[model samples]
Target: MLVTHERLAELGILYLEGTSVESIDRAAHAVILSGGTRLGYERLLLATGARPRIMNKTVEPKSRITTLRTYADAVAIRSTLGPQCKVLVIGGGFIGLEVAASAVTKGASVTVLEAGPRLLMRAVPALMADLIRAKHERSGVRIVTGANVKCIDVNESCSAVFLEDGRKHFANIVLVGIGAVPNVELAQAAGLATDNGIMLDETLATSDPDIFAAGDCCSFPHRLYGERIRLEAWRNAREQGAAAAANMLGAERPYIKVPWFWSDQYDETLQIAGLFREQDALIPRVLGPRGQLLFCLAADGRLVAAAGFGSLGAIAKEVRFAEGMIAQGFAPKPEALANPSISLKLLSSQHRSSL
Candidate 1:
């Protein structure tokens, strides 16, 4: 899955090697490159992406205390990790949890800490978060939430994590997964409007009409949601990039793809479709030879999101149907959705028709 420079070169793309944009001169409608190259474009698309959110601004990461964001990070973790290794992971989000699970698999004793009250508090519904947290604990992953890390004492031999509540944890390796920061320095330097990210219109164009942005670096108005949202996922980035390209070419295409994301921990495949809130009504459907399928419905009765934990094939099959229901604002009957016997595909189709 990830597209490489060689792959793009094969696809008739001119890959500019070692070219860096220093600044953008909007008056001249050109980008100033570091190598004294001025590249002019009719329409510019800034897909800068994002960077990993480190533990602290004051503390610098060394061998023992670091983060897992790149291939090199994985290598470092693997090299240092072994049986009976005590690993301390900060943040109960997806990255931290995933890393903890992987460490546990490699026979490392793992402990994860989250500042928030619950795991994936912003991403998934409360019930789902609880279920997933319980599952992880059962699989030998120690999790702690509402933990305020005051300081970190790092030395060559070991690193100690100090909390404000007078708790200290010493570990062999520390992996931080607080979150990510949008790489918007270039956009900011170019004088484009930015808040949490580069602000984009429904067409994914930025404040400057000639320039556009997408992926994790830009926040665009959501068609289904009435607010501006930025999604950092492989599917979202890929789809938004294509949409931006089409819009830049004078083909008026609005990005209306329902938010979809997935993660794998151990043998289970967790997949989610559409954006779900904690207040959404969760309807669990027990299925055949698979785990439960949880559907999240908004207050207005529209099916907004669904999460599946079981067979990857079953989750993959349900993704499209779930997306359609959310995009169409289809409100499936609670009776139909809660029933275990009714096929999810059929339910979605019927609910969509009812709308």
Candidate 2:
């Protein structure tokens, strides 16, 4: 849904595409910012997302080393690929794998090199990572984990990558999906305090109370985790935007929701419905040959989060009852979770409404 042009238009938010903010000045009742053009607002929100981090010391901003952050980036890569093309993807994270899968489906020879030991190592457990890697490998996508890209060699008509192990991989095109750095220069220039991301309170108000920031650019208080986190997920961004707007209108509601993220690669669709630390114990179960579910239960047995990679209905069911499951440490018996009644739509409506 993220890359879908239809969903992009459905959001209906004012999107100033391909523009970089030049400056921002925030006052009590009004704000002014420059993005190739000047924009004035009574109450301003900085929803500027992040940009992909380029690691190649040699690759310039405008080069064959492309980073996927917008529809244009995807379009550029799609238009450039042809049958029997070789693609070298740097960073085996979600973005990298998704791009590789897309290219492989279009008849490209894809290879993903991850600096870590496993794909999505930081986002999921080792076993889950193995499952994702296996799934991709079955689709003819070669995965090289624990491999680092030392430099990118771009010449007149071709590009190649040099790995730390002195191995070279030639590619018709190169895609760097290392990760993202928040677009907070405007907020920083306006004197807003920022650490990993823009620092904000429970009300989504920055250090400068006159200005509020949301989406991927802001970090705010999280009640469940008992700390502030910078979340870059779509659901978090949309909810935070609405919360910031409400607080600006004197509602003062704290932005408190379990951060959720989802990814679709080839035939596998993965959904994560809550937040859990690295140390959280995951209770895994296989519902069928095609459906798998993981419940992250706390030390006390409360369900902290649910991750699944087969059935959206099943995943949504568990997500809806997430609070009760978390608070009470409840885990459905093996047989109950297998039942058809555990649907995502029903559970989401029943459980999520209380929030």
Candidate 3:
């Protein structure tokens, strides 16, 4: 379904569809090879995204088991499913939980099996995970925690998952909601420096000064974490994309933004404004059912990260406060952050000398 120039002219929008890069030999001064193939360009910016992780040993690469990574995957899953289907999701991370909730709303019986003890164990706090457990179960989604799957038996029509505890769950459909790995084979094959991902410095410049990489495919130095970290969130990707573009224009800018990620499952929207270090302690502050913020404090008493389940506005305020602290090189008292209504403007003006 490649929307050609003629086809695009017929419609209101300039749509280009199904035109594989193999056929389209583009020639330009600055070419961006989005789908591979050489586009003669002085500068190249690679922003290839990541793909979902699914093991063949656990699930057979058949029609029954699927990974919801792209739009095509979502369409395939939705088209082949019905209200009477029983969907067994393998992972209980953000993707797994969101898919299970969507499936349940579509009248399918969904059961989420997570190997970890709690849902979203790596992202949210323990108490927030418990709250999410209650929310999922209340919406007719059965969740099984500490579930280790041994194998997946798949026929032509369906699949039956076997657990280590000898429990078998029959499923008309199965979805693997695990994490993703960066698409850096092209860079690696080209002899570009890559460690875990395409290694880029603070300026988003790859090992090759003429080449720059961004988005999930490149691992750049994060000032907040004081190390090279890869972020897969949309905001990070967009910022990295813009940074790569700016660097290509000879702008001397470095990528030093804080990492943030947000997820929406059913009625709950979780927003995390920063990354958490391993030694950071969690400070829980519950502001009612609709608002709660978890502050991750560093050893030196500075707020490293702030995670909120239902408090989007509060998360923004905290992020602003953190950014201000970074500008002044001053750490605030951990106890002072307890007040939700604390004014960021006042904090920025009054704390100038101390910072």
Candidate 4:
């Protein structure tokens, strides 16, 4: 999704097309393609990524409703949206909000419908969600939460979204961004272990020792989180791909990098580092170069995650220290965290670990 064909060609990369791997014969150490081609390999890495999760099967045939997954999907969406176009976004996750913000920028009338009670319920804390919602509202976007979308009715020209609460929103464009489904059909057919994603070890190797996986398609044990997680961020995928490649070459290295993600809507830059989902409390710190800092602290007192909105320059700094604290399982007093007098560096140094 990040690279273009022209760029790949410029880098002297051999880009293959039309050849699809039908199945993998692990016993024979070969992959059979649809064109009756069999390729043998000593090691294999699966970076299959994911597909956009379908919110409703009934609306799959609707031409107005589009799921943002590929560059083509974005092109199709932009084609439908124009000035004064009523755009209805389903699923208020990252993709939905981003699409809504972009639609607003294009002079489209945007309305975001989220089934959950809060925006970005699974991704960010309630406080951050509130800030994001307010930010979008100020940008002239209508965000409706606790909206239960029953189904979509489509016609020759426009479509209407029917909600369970007896509300119907008519729109010329619909964007779905609920979640993603890991592309694990190949791994499942090959008898490799599978969960919500392909299961892998800390070394990023699948159950089959010769088969390794990375990116959004694989869930590996995280030594830091004490559990397994499948990160969908571009940075995480890039780092994991490199680590998996090195390990596939017989360099045994565990993929234990700290997890982080970022989002940009309007003029604000939002960043989250480490496991923010586990935080029990929010600590607001006002010691950044451009904006205030909101720290997500676990119940045990460690800074599990942190987000800085405003200057990308300052957010980069806070996110770095937050990563260090998360790595050492560092815990500081809430007062210390809220106090701007104590920098994140001081807090990290005062933690149990020397680093």
Candidate 5:
């Protein structure tokens, strides 16, 4: 739905629809297709993306239990939701929370189960997570942390989720959003180097120089963080696709774009830019009653990341400025960043002027 096949064709793209690449013959620089067709490429870019992580392979029901990944899966989930429906989400991450919010909006009774001590444990700081949890709770979403799901028992009418702590919850529909696994089977079979994902250099090239990988399927080095990172965000995927194409055409430019992610649940928008750790020094900037921004600084006081939570109008521009600061490696005074009276735009401009 994002783009039509005709639009892609107009861009001089072949637009292979429903065709699967059976195997890659790296030695011959060609890929065998599902119908025994051989397609040779001067440079191959793999944007295979990722698949949703399954909670329990054995306990998976034929119906009722599902994971959201494709548009079809979303439609199926939406069809099952109603005022009388009871929805159980088995993760407290972005996808699970977002689904829970949508289900609540649809008049479904929603409950979120997080195995971790808190929601968004790996993504955001505790302060922001707490605020997000409060907002969801206020909106009638029941969130249970430290919930270790043992298994699911499915019956005709409903499913019973059993926890390791000897508690049970029942729901008409069970949605799992634990995480995702990068699709690297083809790359791995081709003897390409892969750690967390298809290993790519700054130029997005795979072990074979002619082969490149992008999006959620590849892990590239982050020059700012000095580490390898694989982002599952859509913006990261879109930007990486462009970068990979340019590199494939001999642009030879390093993919050094700042990491950015955003999620919308209910009426609130959460946006984050750059990579940050829980241990990073956080500086808070208050934006009236319903908005706040947190800046994460490294031990050396480098502006590593920023997260904003509020209405789109309240935080979007500020977060964008913070993203530029992170990208430029600007280390503004902690006091200046914490003061809401001072504009982030002004700070960024001043930093650039000083340089």
Candidate 6:
């Protein structure tokens, strides 16, 4: 619903609906379609995105067992949720937790199985993970951490998720949201360089000069972090597409936007800006009873990242200010960051003045 064929046509774009590109002829600067149609292009951009990681080969496709990746998958999952539904979610990451919350909101009995030691162990700090876990538990969601799933046995009406330690949880619906893998097969088959994803330089150009890539399928070096990172968020994908288009038109600009991510579960919202390392110094800013912010400072005291968990109204503004500080490379004193009385907006102003 965001864009229509008419809109694209008005923009002088040729919309090829429901046609798959079979292969790329780099030397001819053309692509072969599914029906053996050859389409030539001066410049090409691959926004192939990603696919949900499957649990294992032993898990066969069933009506009751599913993975959420596309709109259709979400619709299918929603149709199966109700008061009588018993939902079991595999993985405790963002997608799993969000789906669990939605299922619980629909009066479904929900249980989450996470292989990690704690929920969100790779995404956020242990303290933040604990807070999120507590909130979910309070909302009637059963969470099992350090859970090693052996296999899923599906029957006629329900599925049983078996664990390594001789335990099984039966549910009417089983949702898998472990993670995602970039769609790099096409890029690789075309003789393009790929590592984790399609490798791109700072300008989002692929190995072939006439071709480029953006979104989840591309991995570009981040100037702020001094390393290559691929983001699967919607905002990043949208911005990267625009940037890639500009670069294709000879703009010659480097995409250096700071990374920002957010998730909504029940009445709580979690926001993170920039990348945080385990060894980074964490400064806590307590915001009364319902909100808290954690600032991650690098070894040299630079504000590298920030995370906040609470109501949207309580934490959104503060996270915005912190994001600005991180983008500006501000290094406020640890004491100033810890004290809620010292406004982050004021600190941001001071940082701008110093620059």
Alpha-carbon local distance difference test for all models: 0.83, 0.75, 0.75, 0.84, 0.92, 0.90
lDDT-superior candidate, 2 or 6: 6
The per-prediction CA RMSD against the true structure, in angstroms, equals: 2.1, 4.7, 4.7, 2.7, 1.3, 1.3
Candidate 5 residue-wise lDDT, 225-296, digit = tens: 999999999999999999999999999999999999999999899999987785679999989777889999
- Output the number of the lDDT-best candidate: 5
State, as a TM-score between 0 and 1, how close model 6 is to the true structure.
Answer: 0.97
lDDT of 4 by residue, 115-222 (tens): 999998876777778888988999999999999999998665678899998999998877789889999999999999998899999999999999999999989898
lDDT of 6: 0.90
lDDT of 2 by residue, 217-320 (tens): 87887776677788777888888888899998889888777778788888777777667577667767676766577767656545677777765654545555
State every prediction's TM-score relative to the real structure: 0.93, 0.84, 0.83, 0.91, 0.97, 0.97
Q: Where does candidate 4 stray beyond 4 Å?
A: 1-14, 287-290, 349-355
Model 1: per-residue Cα lDDT over 1-355, one tens digit each: 3679889989997667678899999889998999888988889999999888866632444445778778888898888877878899988988888898889889999999899999987677766678678878998998999988988877666788998899988888878888788989999998999978999999999999899998999998887767788888888999999999999999877889899888787777778888886567888776766666789888889888888877687666775677777888888888787787777789776765665
TM-score of candidate 4 to 2 decimals: 0.91
Candidate 6 C-alpha lDDT tens digits along 1-355: 5789889989998888899999999999999999999999999999899998887733665444678988889898899899999999999999999999999999999999999999987668888889999999999999999899998987768889999999999998889889899999889999999988999999999999889999998899998888889988888998999999999999999998888889999988999988888889999898987888999999989998999999888788888999898887888999999998888889899879888
Error of 6 at 289 (Å): 2.3
Q: Is candidate 4 or candidate 5 better by TM-score?
A: 5
Worst 10 residues of 5 by lDDT: 55-64
Whole-model alpha-carbon lDDT for candidate 3: 0.75
Candidate 4 local lDDT, residue 71: 89
Ranking of models by lDDT: 5, 6, 4, 1, 3, 2
Candidate 3 Cα misplacement greater than 4 A, ranges: 1-38, 58-63, 79-82, 311-330, 341-355
